[model samples]
Target: MSSTILPVSELTPSAAASEAEDSGGKHPFLVALGQRVRDIRARRGMSRKALALATDVSERHLANLEYGVGNASVLVLLQVAVALKCSLAELLGDPTTQSPEWLMIREMLENRDEATLRRAREAIGELLGSGSAKASARSRRGSRVALIGLRGAGKTTLGSMLAEDLGFPFVELSREIEKFAGCTISEIQGLYGQNAYRRYERRAIEEAIQIYPEAIIATPGGLVSDPASFNLLLGHCTTVWLRALPEDHMARVAAQGDMRPMAGNKEAMDDLKTILAGRAAFYSKAEFQLDTSRQPLQPTFLALREMVRNALQMDQTEHAE
Candidate 1:
């Protein structure tokens, strides 16, 4: 599906300026975090209202937070953090990582150094291909590759690639609902509002799972904004995070099409960062994180494949034992 881009004239002056002022801003991070929050919420099938009820925060505030607004106070932030079962530091962006193996591998991949990428791929391939390597039972038991990241993090693009390469069917949760309703997502939002859209999305996801249990599914970046649906997803599948920089997300989304998020909203970038600050805790819950910034399609795909292979093999070994 094509991305929607809003023109400069349509964007609120403040929103445009915010985008411009953010030098390597927090939009991408916020997008990822928001997605994670939404996914967790959706998999739980909890509505925004439900989250509000649990956190004692207003629905509008929740919406604003999800949209990447800057109104979230420390108190409100703590409430959300507690409700989501996470620590404050994690939600506030923990920068003191000791550099995990995956991060190093991802860095190597992002370097665009052919030798390093090839070696990484070969090493992964050999590890998986070894005779003593475990068989892939996770694939048989039905693993889910739910895409989590800010909008325009190539979740859809990478999802399609994953489904095709893995020989599984691909389903975009948002697109499925749009197709089912016979209307664009924006239209649905305008007509029924976020709650109603979630209702439709919930149905679409349930139906999709029943129809194709083992498939690659590309959920809307914001699906996790609603708790009920997010929980449902978590119960049904394994999730992966498509990590990227905020600027990258804005650029990609802008290039693809819809600028509505940035339009007429002067605080768009700041709002994005704020949202990410709240949601990072949730997204960090995912099983794997795939950093796609500056990483090409081929190596990223290979890395994902390797991750899936490892997961499957682990599952198989568990079953065998």
Candidate 2:
């Protein structure tokens, strides 16, 4: 059985709105939803017929959905989202749209001074049981430490050392993401797009948290770009920013036999500098900051060991209290 294809003209926002109006005051939300579905399906390069087959919906019904004339059930929407390999939220609204929790927070902060609002937000988060706040508190009582920095900042090396010294598991988050995606990070980005990569990154973090309650995590450099996943990291792990000069970062990568940093690129160092500058604000949010630039590896290792030891001691004290 062949499915009906929606005409380009019928898929337009104006046409969708008219169709909604003609349907006896059916809400315009269906039009928006249909558009969203069509856009995502197109982006994923899935044909409507393929999607319909995967989602167990008729192609004719799917055409009506794309034309913003069908009233799709929640179950149908969910199945479509599953077929498209996205969250229901992603299908229903923009990914960056502020959630209800954020809206409530904005309203609560109205007319408040910065300092007062900060304190009030903390208190309210604790009172209303904010997941990030609660996770942060739990992190202080647990044994998870995440190292954040640019590539070649010694996160993997130092994290492995610290984990071995402390008798805890060491996890590289990017590797976990690749494992979950059943491919390399590069492959994931190439095959699924950056948004999908971010989704996998979040899922990898969540799984790591569950699998290794007491572990050292070495995170990807761009992990901070995703606010939700970064917040989850900040809330659940004692983060340390491993700092280094751009020149040193370049030198280290070259030393590791990965000339990709400078290969065929005269402006690689400049690009590194720009990236570091852009991410400095986010990296500075870590509870601990350690500079590993222009120092011997052994001395840097010693300093990192001391920092981790102190942090663990502090965590123990907080738990005891």
Candidate 3:
């Protein structure tokens, strides 16, 4: 059971040219598909050879896939997706973009700038009754402030302080998750695995949202790993990214006596950086972010307090010195 990709048989230049000609002007769909495959592979931290082994698909076919010349059969595509641990839809994109009007609209929006795309997303959300128009956005956002970021970013401490100041209940979601599973996080993951742990995590969040309207919630660092749960938090709470420097993160985690990451693992810093980079885009989706490393805890708390109060439209003069 070796997880090794067999050697790939190279295609001749004439054969490549024939593939090009047969694809009818480079096959726009498959070209985008190949690019998508490459991007997903990178994000998943899998080398092309690794992916080939995981899928049990030939390296030559995967090479064709990356080259945008592979007319992959349904079975082959399914195997690759299963190996990649993502749905075929996610890897290939929504299959519903088939109609002429749908294709044209999609094409038009595909090249628009981020700002334009964001505005379009907002509009679509509103029209679909899932956006800000459906609720008093400020009230909803102000009531629930969810802290997100790396584990050592002071989410627990800050969440408690902010909650007490706002007279809202403070919920450390990780604790609730453990309660739901009837074991510690390490035990949950070790015994049942990550998938089971994520299920517990999702349920914990759902229950938190349903039961507590006015609360300051400190979420697990990896909550963003599950898009459904992350989207739920985004829709229901005012999310904040509690940022810290890489050195600060390590120091803080070590100070807390959690040496799991750094214990005998010399590449811990590099791994931490990679995790940060991979999840940075998702963290940036937070409505607000504060860098805790720039100032002392008290000042950082004060700044966070100010930001949250303003976001929730609470009394600013109460804590004024």
Candidate 4:
């Protein structure tokens, strides 16, 4: 007996062509589908061979599928979804699209007036409760505080100070990421690509949380760009956003004797400002916010120290009750 291979023409030719056209030649549905499969598999720490074996598909075919050129059958896709432990809809849907729950919420609010929608949103928030309540409960039992900010925002300096004050370990997430990649962050990005770097970043955060459940962690500035990893960070650690003015950020970076920010670009300040603006919304999701611009180092440190101490004490009191 011989096995039969399906051709691309047999796999819904019209639909594929329509998708390719809709994407304006940037990425067809199949390519996006393959990328989604690869990302999910990476997050689960599964190899292509493992997925192939689980799906009962040949390694070569699985490779083609991941590469976004395979003309996979519906049955094959279903098997792949099952093997990846995800729904078929997830495998086939847009990778960048919002989750189904958010989409349904949007649809439900589409026809409502602004006032009604606002009330509904408030009710939903009240019913679901704040993420901070859950975080406070966890903080009483675990001492994980994650500091988030841009490069020159003093995350490393302040994180070390806080860790020492609290008698907790301090971990720089970038260093962990480098350790996982077996090279520097720049080298990892150059070698494997940005997506691969993010995968390593996510894995590094997971490992860090597992290893140092009671520690202060300094995270990369752009970690929030990846929603899934950022959500994991928020869920596991009590996050603090250390903020500063754009000028202070630039001055601090320069004070460190690292001129890389202005090494090749005359518009480095403009770029930095743009990056800050883009990430401000995500940074605001942190449990606490502290501004570190233009203040004396001693004063800022003391304030942060006192704030953290109070927060921890409050959590402990709540737990006692």
How do the predictions measure up, each by TM-score?
Answer: 0.55, 0.65, 0.65, 0.65
In order, candidate lDDTs are: 0.66, 0.80, 0.78, 0.77
What's every prediction's RMSD, in angstroms? 19.9, 12.9, 12.7, 13.0
Tell how far residue 293 is off in model 2, in angstroms.
0.4
How good is model 3 by TM-score? Answer: 0.65
Q: Give the count of colliding residue pairs in each prediction.
A: 43, 0, 0, 0
- Candidate 2 residues 1-321, lDDT tens each? 444333322244576578778877656778767777877776677888899889999888887776567587889989999998766776676533225465355556768975685567446546655433533466432778999999989999889988998899999999989889999998999999999999999998888888887999999999998877877787778889999988888988999998889975758888899999999988986789999885888888889889988987887776667
RMSD of 4: 13.0
Deviation (Å) of 302 in candidate 2:
1.2
Candidate 1's residue-wise lDDT over 189-246, tens digit each?
9997988788889898788767876778888877778766765565556678888777
Q: Give the winner by lDDT.
A: 2
Better of 1 and 4 by lDDT: 4
Tell me the deviation in Å of residue 67 in model 2. 20
Per-residue lDDT over 106-145 for candidate 4, one digit per residue giving the tens place of the 0 to 100 score: 6677679756864664355445542234534364326788
Q: In model 2, where do residues sit more than 4 Å from their true spots?
A: 1-136, 139-141
Distance from true position, residue 316, model 2, in Å? 1.5
TM-score of 1: 0.55
